[model samples]
Target: MTHSDTDTLRAIQHTERERFIASHPRSMALARDAQQHYLFGVPLHWMRDWPSPATLFVAQAQGATLTCADGVGYADFCLGDTGAMFGHSPPALAHAIGEQAARGLTCMLPATNAAVVGGLLSKTFGLPMWQMALSASDANRFVLRWARAITARPQLLVFDGCYHGAVDDTLVDMDPLTGGTLPRASVLGQVHNHAAFTRVVPFNDLPALETALKQGDVACLLAEPALTNFGLVPPDTGFWEQARALCREHGALFVCDETHTVSTALGGYARAHRLDPDFMVVGKAVAGGLPCAVYGFTHDMAERMVQAKNAAPEGHSGIGTTLAGNALTLAVLQASLEHLHTAANYAKMLDLASVLEQGLRDRIAASGRPWTVTRLGARMELQFMSHTPRNAQDVRDHAQSELEAFTHLFMLNRGVLLTPFHSMMLVSPATTLNDVAQLLAVFDELLAALRALPARPATAPASRSA
Candidate 1:
């Protein structure tokens, strides 16, 4: 972008910020009160990442809508960043939570419904053995430990710009200049070097993945079926097929982290596409917004896990937490599996998402903007570049920080909430055609507003950490 483009973006952002502040007096007041006790005026640091000047305090959230403390309602495309992918507080999950709460919460012992839930998980995910965790971060960490223990290997491999939650091993980035792993610069208080045991490679790069796996030291290749953190970069055609083969050929486990890509299909992208990973992790919306995650593995992998455990000294195996697999979470998980994770819900989500994807593509073309929309089942991303990115490097090369921030704030000001980290949107089963139409109308307004600005020739975007 040129100086004129930058000035115009900043000017629009200023107006949007002013509008937001004026309309959110209640939120502003709450934020002021919260700053006295809560760090960054929020419960979690990430809650402060939104472009709004003050944290938007929620009054209520249900279905696909969120109402802020200022009585402003929004079409919630963010959906708690996939934690509410099945829509906020589905009745089945809510009732299950209430019923389970009255019975028991956690007892550090298996719930009576544990065996039934296990059967549901195995039948749904096509994996015979399973484990539970409070979050996908914990699940990924435990999977890594198991993979390393069973294989007796020291290194793990992951794709560039992949996010498997807050797992330390998956946090390293692939250095573009050196083609080696480097500790992510933005991570705080990192004493240990994650790159020492984690090999990083670009997504959709078969040769790089093969070469890395051929090293024989890698225990597992942890990956999302499609890259979601940096942007929606889907794997190239036949990428997973060949990638899984290479892992098997090199004697490494292929672990698919479907936390985000769970939106891809009812059973997730791996099962829908027949990737058949050695292990799989699904979280976020798994229990209809409850704090639960489950990882599954093949029977062979289960046997290896047992053998590894039996061979080790019997103390703590460094896996799981006390709160995992609690009775409440299990009840909700069962309810979600029975009701939310169904063909009917997915059909509605996918149909509406197709309409949304086409609407975005049509608007972008009519506006003649150099933007592209990529879709995976019910999720879509409107990238600034003309082509869909294949890797994190591509995402970095086309990064438009100012434009992205402006888009998010502009939409938020218009009663639409997008994912704060990127130009991503998710279609939930609760989303309606009117909601999608409202979003498109606002998006059209955004396009027109940008079109009114001074035009400039595009330039290479400055590299920035995500």
Candidate 2:
């Protein structure tokens, strides 16, 4: 490692802290205004990630931009972290949802649209049978339960740093003190031992994964198509093929949670990559911002799941929700399948992602900084490390809070908004080349500002934590 690079980054962080505090008058005023009613001065706890005394209140948003309470607008590349990746209020979805809301929001009965939507899912994702839930978390929980019941296995395997939307078993990790995941105390109010059902392994490590499933107790391996939550760690070359082989060998189901990765193709990354998952869970953008998630199972697994469900007496099987597959959700899903999830939308988003990726790469390179960018179709993120990380620890270890604050705040001030927590941004179909150009201009300025700083001490000043 070169000494000069470290010095430059330190200097950048020093100036960033001071510069960030000095500006943000509008954001500061709004934060003070909001602290009166909301806990942690924000509605949701995580909104504090953006650079402000409190979270910036969003007034109005459309397509790829948001107007804050202070009346400043941002080229919103975050897109609600893929929930709005279909583009906020796309005309067809909005019209259909509005009509459905007027007709009926949720009825206990199934709608004809459900069959149509199911058919579309079958065509797009190659799954023979389908089920509905409120979110990806529910789908994962359902998948785990069904897998266990069908296989009569008691355990599951998951990769470290993989987030499947608050599924209970996924909460296990390398212990803070012991480095082996037992029941973690940080998971407040969780009464059961999650470690009893879960085995956590590092990504791209086949030996580790095989070891976990070799016991033949893991019912399934729940994972993202490519781990995106740990800041876009693409699977190592040949990682997926080996992982698939091991699952076959170990009698564990391969469940791909494409909740965040549905942006990659008309179906998802799974279909695009020819991943023949026994079960698939996707949410976030499927129903055009509605609280709906759906899952599909292969024909063989579908029969088993049906039999397992039929064996259970009706009323609270722990897998069904009243609001799931409601008339409104079905209508919205049908509309989204007809409009948003089309080939044209995928093409548009992919083109925009390429532009954003190229711009970030060029800007980062010009600054002479040792950082990298990762792209997963419409989703792109800039990570402050020279190379992509291999596992959860690598990602956490390489995290640079001061630099992240600097980058996010700098972008916020200049009318561009990235996702609050990390350098992640999703290019929506509504996003334009002009928005991309403006972001590049602003990012260029921020990089130049960082470059101008004289190297400071290695220790960076304290700031907000992610």
Candidate 3:
């Protein structure tokens, strides 16, 4: 890039920094070179969340912090979007990985830890059988396929604005007119018509769910106990009982994706709340920041699911990955189950999250701002609106982008970090009280600054009231 172009980019970035500044020269310089090789300027497109010029290229992460290229250290509340929710490179997880590297990696064979982990899962989730996958998305896909086969049903049901990690069956959206899935306009290049195979209903609406289920073609109801991606919309009281009852009446399997909400308790929100889903998926931090994800089924369901699959023409089912259930991963899972993710760890995390959420909520109220913080397990989010949202659309309608960017940058600039996405924050056992206080202090400052800003302009395209 020419000096003039570089200077122009810098000028635009200067304007952005005037608007958002989590960067300090070094991050910008690094971003310039990175854009030449990597797409969207940073290694990952989503890393753009750090600040105006670019994301602070991370040098290393230890415990609950980020060491950036600019030599600034930040308290990392993002925690790799819960991928490192147990705290980055935890000792037990690391030791297990190193030990397992020597013990041999992948084989179609099961490690002795497999049975132990299975029992642990059964104890934690109240589900008797467990299956491993490389990611929560993959596990969800396999679960849906199993559901389809066992029930011999063609239609799948997911909540509106629910995210199940890129599985095709779960991608179908609500048709604006028919109010049913319609090869979702956003769905692209799919060989199979997902609309024909999927249905979406407003969450927490038992009548809506029952109406759809009445068709009798629904295979499974895939959902997060709490919606995270579409902003953390928790279900209304007793919503689960009503929804589960509807599914039972409809003969649809209930698959709860506790990938994010599992941080709620050792068994996940489902077990904690006594909601008995046919299958439960807990991922992201299950193996203590390693690449492991799992799904569990009740004993009867597991037997039937396996039989249904075996009764099919055999080949790779496109379900399991080569490195999934590898020795290193299993060892990590074993160590994680034994040393981390314990009852004590969960209690600590949930308590810290409660503190953080209360602090933010108090600060928001003190600022006289229209915002509220909500918590589910160890995950808590501060939605930028006065009134709480009831559903995804309500949350989306009230989202405040400028306010979110401002708050995120404000936190980064002050040495506290939060998730890049506007939706959430994660708390791990390793997160300290001082660290939580730091975040609250930063948030207090951001809300104060936002209060100083002039009235929202009619031209402001982004919603900041989320």
Candidate 4:
């Protein structure tokens, strides 16, 4: 881009940042005080990652709207990054949680709802057995141990740019230039070398995947149905079928993480697409925004898990935590699955997302910019590239950090919110057509402003390091 173009973008970003601060005085005050208590001026470090000049303080959130501390309401397309995907405080889940809390919270012992939840999970994900965890990260970690025990292998294979939570092993990324696995720079306090045991390959590349699996030392191929982290990268045709077949052929378990893709359907992407995964994980919205996750496996995999446990030394087994499968979590998870996570609700979400997808496409077209939108079920992302990215490297090669930041800040200032970390937006059962239209209208204005910038020759792409 030219100097004039850079100046225009910076001027727009500055104006938006000032507008946000001027409107959210209460939020800025709270953040100023919070800085003394919280390390990053927020409870969680990721909360600081939003595009706002200061961390926006939430007063309350219900359905698809969130009111900030300054009393400004926003159409919350982010939805707590999928933890609130079913919508905040759904009546059934809230009631279940309140009742369960009155009785007890955590007891290390199984609750009466355990058997019912297990059966529901089996039917939902087409798996025979289930286990619980506090989060998707825990489920992924435990499943990795089980996979290693079952396959007697030490290495775990994951596609590039895939995120399976904060699992130390899964945090490794494939170096774009060298095509070698390395620990992601974003991961902090790392004591172990994850690349030593975590094999990385590009998604949608069957030749690379086959070569990695043929090594005969992989315990499991952990992946999402699509690459969702660095914007959306939907799988190519017949990708899962061939990948699952290769996993079976190489004596490795195909572990599908549906924490994000559960929005694909009530049955999750694995069952929705008819892909046979040896193990499946569903988290985030599984318990209606509660801190809970579940992992399930096929009957054969269950038997292998039992055998592996029995054959091991009588000890911790390094699988589950004491607070896992607590009474409160089981009750809420059961309530969410039976009441909120239903086909009817998903149909509504899908319809709204379709509307959003087309609106984004129309807006992008009007701008005459080389951009594309990708969708997987109710989730969609707008990428500043000419076409959909096939892998993480492709995403990095076309990433537009400054453009993303300006767009995010502009939208947030206009009482709309997209996922701050990316250009992704999700439609929940509670998200209305009006809310989506509002977002698109704001985006249309922003695109028009961006389109006024002077065009220039292309330069080398920059990664989103921050």
Give lDDT per model, in order. 0.92, 0.81, 0.79, 0.89
lDDT of 4 by residue, 164-266 (tens): 8889898888987777899888778998988789999999999999999998999999999998887789999998889989998999899999999998887
Judging by lDDT against the true structure, name the best candidate: 1
lDDT of 4: 0.89
Summarize candidate 3's per-residue lDDT along 1-466 as a digit string, tens digits. Answer: 2345335434543554654343477777887898899888866566775545466778889888888887888888889889898899999888888888888888889887888878877876788888999899899998888888899998889988777886888876666467777554555588887776788888787888999999999989999998887778888999998899989988999999999888778878898998899998878888877878999998889788778878889887767788888878888988887888788988899898988888887776666666778888889888776665677667766766655665676677788777876657899888999999888877776655544353232122353221
Task: Report the lDDT tens digits of candidate 2 across residue range 166-214.
Answer: 7778876765454456654446689887777788888888888888889
Give every collision pair in model 4.
none
lDDT of 2: 0.81
Ten-residue region with minimum lDDT total, candidate 3: 457-466
Q: Which whole-number lDDT from 0 to 100 does residue 250 have in model 3?
A: 82
Over 340-383, each residue of candidate 1 has an lDDT whose tens digit, in order, gives 99999999999999999999999988877888999999999989
Off by over 4 Å in 3: 1-23, 49-51, 182-192, 454-466
Query: Candidate 3 overall Cα lDDT vs. reference?
Result: 0.79
Error of 4 at 13 (Å): 0.2
State, as a TM-score between 0 and 1, how close model 4 is to the true structure: 0.98
What's the CA RMSD for each of the models?
A: 1.2, 3.3, 4.9, 1.4
